[model samples]
Target: MNWKKSLRAAGLVTALTFSLVGCNTEGSYSPQEIIDHALQETKEPLTYYGEYTMDMGEAGGKAQVKEWSKDGKRRIETISENGEHNIAVNNGSQIIMYDVVKNTVHKIDISKDGLDDFPSQRDQLEILFNTVKDTHDVKIAGEEKIAGRDTYKIVAKAKKNDTLIGDIEVWVDKKTWVTLKTITNSAGNKMTTEYTKLDDSAKIDDAQFTIDIPKDAKVEEISVPESESVKLDTVKEQLGEFLMVPEENGLTLDGISLDKGIEDRSEYTFNYSKNGQQNISVTVFKANSNANKVEPVFGEKEMDIRGQKGSVMDENKFRSISWQENGYQYSIFIGNSELTIEDLVTYAKQMTIVK
Candidate 1:
């Protein structure tokens, strides 16, 4: 398989594996108790080698993953589909990724960029637990046998039926709290993953977390650019005189971030917040010549914003509006706020070029 197909399959597996499970009424432990127990058990450092299979509705593949972590250092070795070997190592301060097929290595410094290191299994599980706690109703389904070990089955169903994830089910290893099997449904498509082999008690050396780049491999250094905060009056000085902003909205200017876009073009991002909670972002960049010819995604509808033809997409918990004006393409994103489509359209309609 090509790289893009491999990446798509990997993404599908990740989405399905972490999708939240649903609740049952017959288990001995309360849903919250089970989640808390699983969270607490993930704090320990350990090593595991496992073989797993991912089955999407239209695509399927299998891989072997060896993971080890201790004292904030972590490593993962994956033999993905088509026998592609990939290695990632994080030593608390930096991350190095190596691809065996391409014979290339890429390094990023976490400390200098103000970014966190690569996430470990415990971190992922904590995120999953928080997602279940905040958005879904979870229950301990029952017990099951996975990879020769007894496990607890948990299910989580989203309170909102229109979410991308319809429902999820997971079988958690009783002793380690690690997930062994996961099944998820999203938009009428189903995906499942199961661990065929697991060795949690393997002794791993600290050197296992380190990667030595080969002499013949090509090396690339990834740079994380910093954003500059500019005053509203200076926006026209940086961008052009044609950029627009809403003057009457309750949203307050958080900051403006400038980044490099395609072919060295400059992109400007405006950040706004309401009552210190609701966050809204607007991005403006040079519009491609073909931008007007692109087709909208499913469920998006054509609309008129400020007399410019645009598209509006509304999902379960998020909404966005995009349009091309003059020589720029602008997009506005509203995330998980109480704002409705009418509110978003009102905001869009009130936009005026800064004088």
Candidate 2:
């Protein structure tokens, strides 16, 4: 329970259960109907305290979480191993995160920063359900009892064998439609999160949604720079030379966006689309010369493109090829396309850095 070490893993559970309000609806519903009802029920404001456990095959941890939300305002407090307390409060406009051990607070402006929607129970569920509904096959796995409550077990299995999400099983409470337990298998590793105690009827004070930072604590402002859309010539003027257009492949330049990179560098993205449906992007950026060379991940294989050795990573949703050339790293991503590894390599071979 090193709080700092286990904070991220515990935060996932907190995000998934931030504002689950129960509904009064009754009657048997299809698995999708139940999920839809649960997603809709999250629109109401409620408070809850629960104990969550996360078990990965090799590592696992637990945390105590208390959350309160009304309207768009939210506050979540997580106490993990070593009594590490992390507090996050979103007052509709800005998000403030306090680290108790470090005695510091970080504030982020949601609108100005282009941040994703605040992690409300509704938002989290929407993202989870939408991703699975389109890519995975969903069905009812039966019924079970979780934490003394009746629940319907719903299973979502990946449609393709190469997907990162192998399978996910969720036990939805019959009365509240809240997820009591979730088991996810990805990349041959299983992780399960279960709520041992759920108190949705608890009285939450207004003070719980506000954080009282010590006067001596330091405050830091975090800003996320906006991505800049630029033309190809502008990119070449900055990075000298990189990949050019490949009109031969029926790929046309859709747009280019630039963003801040690590170590004060810049990242350039070249977006290409085919028939306005299929999209392929080539991203080029600098890497530290002394940094360890990139290695292939699971399911990646060695390949050669334009005399440069690289690796091709093939997954269910997207296919990517990455390599280092002329002191810069380049990666090409093809999303939901029928392009083969050889097809991608052919495109990679045509990339040239202008002098």
RMSD of each: 5.4, 4.8
* Candidate 2 lDDT, 1-355, residue by residue in tens: 0111222342243335523445757777788887776777544565555566555554445566665655657777877766778899887777899999989999888866444534556667666667557678989989999878798899988887655456788888887777888887654457777777777676666676678999999999987566799987888788786665466657788888987765556888888888877567888876578855443333566788667887776654457787778777787878446876766777887876564
Model 1 over residues 293-314: C-alpha lDDT tens digits?
A: 5544434678897789888866
Worst 10 residues of 2 by lDDT: 1-10
The alpha-carbon deviation from the true structure for residue 83 of candidate 2, after best TM-score superposition, in angstroms, is 4.1
Tell me model 2's lDDT, rounded to 2 decimals.
Answer: 0.69
Clashes of 2: 1
Model 1 segments more than 4 A misplaced: 1-13, 16-27, 41-43, 54-62, 112-120, 123-137, 158-162, 185-191, 261-264, 275-279, 290-304, 307-309
Best by lDDT: 2
User: Candidate 1, after superposition: displacement of residue 354 in Å?
Assistant: 2.3
Candidates' TM-scores?
A: 0.78, 0.82
lDDT for each candidate structure? 0.66, 0.69
